[model samples]
Target chain A: MKLSREEVVHIAALARMSMSEAEIEKAREQLANILENFAVLKEVDTTNVSPTTQSIKLQSVMRNDIPGESLPAEKILANAPDREGDLFKLRPVLE
Target chain B: MTDKYTDLTIHSAHELLKAKKISSVELTKHYLDRIKKVEPQVRAIVTVTEDSALQQAKQADEAIANGKATPLTGIPVLIKDVMCTKDIKTTCSSKMLENFVPPYNATAVEKLNNAGAVMVGKANMDEFAMGSSTENSAFFTTHNPWDLSRVPGGSSGGSAAGVAASEAIYALGSDTGGSIRQPAGFCNVTGLKPTYGRVSRYGLVAFASSLDQIGPLTKDALDSALVMNVISGYDSRDSTSAPEAVPDYTKGLTKNLKGMKIGIPKEYFVEGMQAEVETAIKDAIRKLEELGAKVEWGVSLPHTRHALAVYYIIAPSEASANLARYDGSKYGFSYKDTDSMWEGMEKTKQLGFGPEVKRRIMLGTYALSSGYYDAYYLKAQKVRTLIRREFDQAFEKYDALVTPTSPTVPFKIGEKADNPLQMYLSDICTLPINIAGIPAISIPAGFAKDLPIGMQIIGKPFAEKTIFKISYAYQQVTDWHKKTAKL
Candidate 1:
């Protein structure tokens, strides 16, 4: 349950977040405390219990694989922070 | 006459609009005026759609005059900013989406619009519906109408406070854990969290997908029922939306509970619960007993103690995944200071999210990380099954269960802002219902030191009607729901 600074940084990287040293220290302490509270779950005996991903039981819904009308390029790009022509503009992925 | 329009519930407003006693435009204007007057003190609204509301209200009047009106026609409604509103900003009280307006409406918003309901404005909430108190809002915290210094329990605090202050007749909010119910309890309004899959989630912004549900916050239980009728139904757009038929929820509003069995779980009365909250809930139970319903005590939900721990794990894990959509390149706030896209993505998230959101995302990432996944995420899911089974057993012996909606009345802002665990504990009474995917409602039972107390009625899956029946009956006898904030 004790989260080290290294672990916090690794988790942040995985989550695609850049945290300052103060935030990392704060997260290290807070996440450790939260996980410590979750330690009680270890006491429950779930030898054969199945994991519940969804609360309500339902079969995956299927739909026709046909092409359908989609949002116009203009509408889809309306909220994009950076756009070029009809495509989302981003800093080069590889340099 | 203006006061009369401001005081009208959705049900009453519908009648007045139909009888030609009030026009939709007039009713919408009265609420807009109320919002203008009270919003400075309450801070419940994020964006007031004055122009669009009046235009919609004029359209509703035309529909009513043309004799083609629905039950919700001409009724002004406040929407939780988490739901998509076409051409209107849906911020979720986060800087990430501060100026992000959707091009299409959420299924719930579409349904309400089809019912002729006017969108008054978007109510404020915690960023991404992450916190128990509105303090987590990136913009500002919502004040409880009853006590301006106290927080309206959130992340649906704005929706609850709006209804209590007559800023809106009824508001829609999404509940993940106790977002809707706790705030409704704090603000002395009736809030319902319909069974998961009973309502469509197509347009709702996902926080913890499995646990989230959109419901109503209203002046009373009957208003909740009326709103439910308009909003609940299966939609092909939401894969998780149940295929089962949505009944006429209003038909369950009768003030009768003969032969009903209500269970009181012993685990809910924890050590730190406010003495006043305990007393109000017990008094409400006695009232139910006097109304010919049987009350059973000592019902054991042994897994209840572990629900909080389970929720913190599962909810954050889902949130981390759901929130991954907010990277800089697409929509929302982007960080352009960095030349590399990867650095920009990271910087955007760092700048966009607040403390609580980052904390949750970190916790979720750590739990779902390679080696830790089995120990944290898998273990929590297995315990979740146990929690659901405990409710299943309790429901077998009782028609519904009753508990104090919150362990205490609304607390002052900043009292528990620094302490995350304590804030999470505020939702102790309501989280189990969400984990079980059952329907539950928080109705005003009484007041504690001038602040409202809510008693929760929980029912089996898709049993909103049963909870409505019990809640409506309780409202018929008590004046709690009739009291309004002096603001």
Candidate 2:
């Protein structure tokens, strides 16, 4: 169950985390060790069993579409690392 | 010269407050002074809100003067750093959120605030509530109050340690998989992880959204029950919040355990578990029998063996999705000096999160990735359904389940630091309850060479009152919980 360097790199890309070569090697080793334990799940007989997304039964929650009280705009934006007049300013996504 | 307030329980403290024997401000100041003296060794609190605590205490004093006081009025309490406290820095002990402050209180915090509870400070935790040991915290590891070299089991390590060290009367802790109960066991305190949906998760930072829950860590079962009465209820803010009618938990919490049926699951007593811990739990079970509760052993939960695997898969998968919010674009740390937006996002995650966080995100991404979903994520969910069914059937035959809270007493800080799987094994005793979405409490049962041991009581969903009654009755006869850390 040793994850390859390429597989770890792919997961890091999918997770949007950049790792150095040393970190990737370490992650490959650790994640492989963790996944090896997961191999035990293959022994269970799960025929016709449904997946549980959550433990409790959930229903479609429909509430009235109305705004009662919201956080003040200034306060909500106060923690923004880079804000430009109530807008979160970020680097350009495209050229 | 010594502070008497540090040793007062919520029941006694409430009587004193009502009789005007001690003003709220005086009690609050006593704890703050105690924190100043003892906090150096424990390192439990991340941020001490001194000014806000004094103001809240003054307001509570005025309310008492007006002859209007509630159970928690003017009580000094600590909050887990994962919960947002409006205007107070809520660091999850990570560099990514070291300065992040919310504009609104978490529903639990709001409830405590509304009840006039003074905010002593925010307790530290594992980074993003990810690890079994608080050593994963970016700032510092919370030491077990009993032995400073040992770890206070975590991710709620600081909360449990603070209560054990008498830094705070009680504290709030979140449990996804045994976070609260394990720490409470190590620190010699009572910790309850309420049934999922019993408490609102709004303003509490999400980690494995489906599995995460909030509860109280306190000195005694009565104090834990009183705090549960305040924080457990429905809220529209969290979608998963239950709509069940809230019951007064302390109403029938008497020392009467007559006619209660308790079952002991045989699967939890696996090999490699410490001999002392097993003896302590067995002694506590005998005590329950003495108190009139029928203790049934050899109760079976066949699927218990697979809980650890299912939890690792499901929790990380949910965590990967829940933590996608921390891209550093909104309110947390942002790394923008990179070449492009994509690079900035990647670099923010790279530099902000610690090694364990990255490992989990990687693990989650791998599990949910194409071609592997069916084998890992989907299969785990199906097994989760089976695990939940076993608990449902077991409850049909018993009122509650009894087991050891942790496999062993507190270990040295660096004992399992290098091995992730070994650390995960530490949570084996408490993980099945969370997978089944049931409520459980870890009450101090006995000690092993001065290190405390806790026996866990598992009840059916929304059955906090039953477990509290059993623990209260058990503590009434045994003085194990009254023993405090000699810090």
Candidate 2 chain B, which ten residues in sequence have the lowest lDDT sum?
B1-10
Query: Per-residue lDDT for B9 in model 1?
Result: 83
Residue pairs that clash (backbone atoms under 3 angstroms), model 1: none
Q: In model 1, which runs have C-alpha deviations exceeding 4 angstroms?
A: none
Candidate 1's TM-score reads 0.98
Give the Cα error of residue A44 in candidate 2, in Å: 0.2
lDDT of 2 by residue, B296-354 (tens): 99999999999999999988888888877788888888897876877888888988998
lDDT of 2 at B113: 94
Candidate 1, B36: how far from true, in Å? 0.7
Give one digit per residue, the lDDT tens place, for model 1 in B1-487. 1355556787888889999998999998988999989999999999999999999999999999999988889898999999999889999999999989888899999999999999999999999999977999999999999999999999999999999889989999999999999999999999999999988998899999999999999988788888999899888889899988888888956667889999999999998999999999999999999888999998999999999998999999999999998998889999988788889999999999999998899888888999989988999899999999999988899999999999999999999999999999999999988888999999999998899999999999998989989998998999999888887
Native contacts present in candidate 2, fraction: 0.87
- lDDT over C-alpha atoms for residue B304 of model 1: 95
Error of 1 at B452 (Å): 0.4
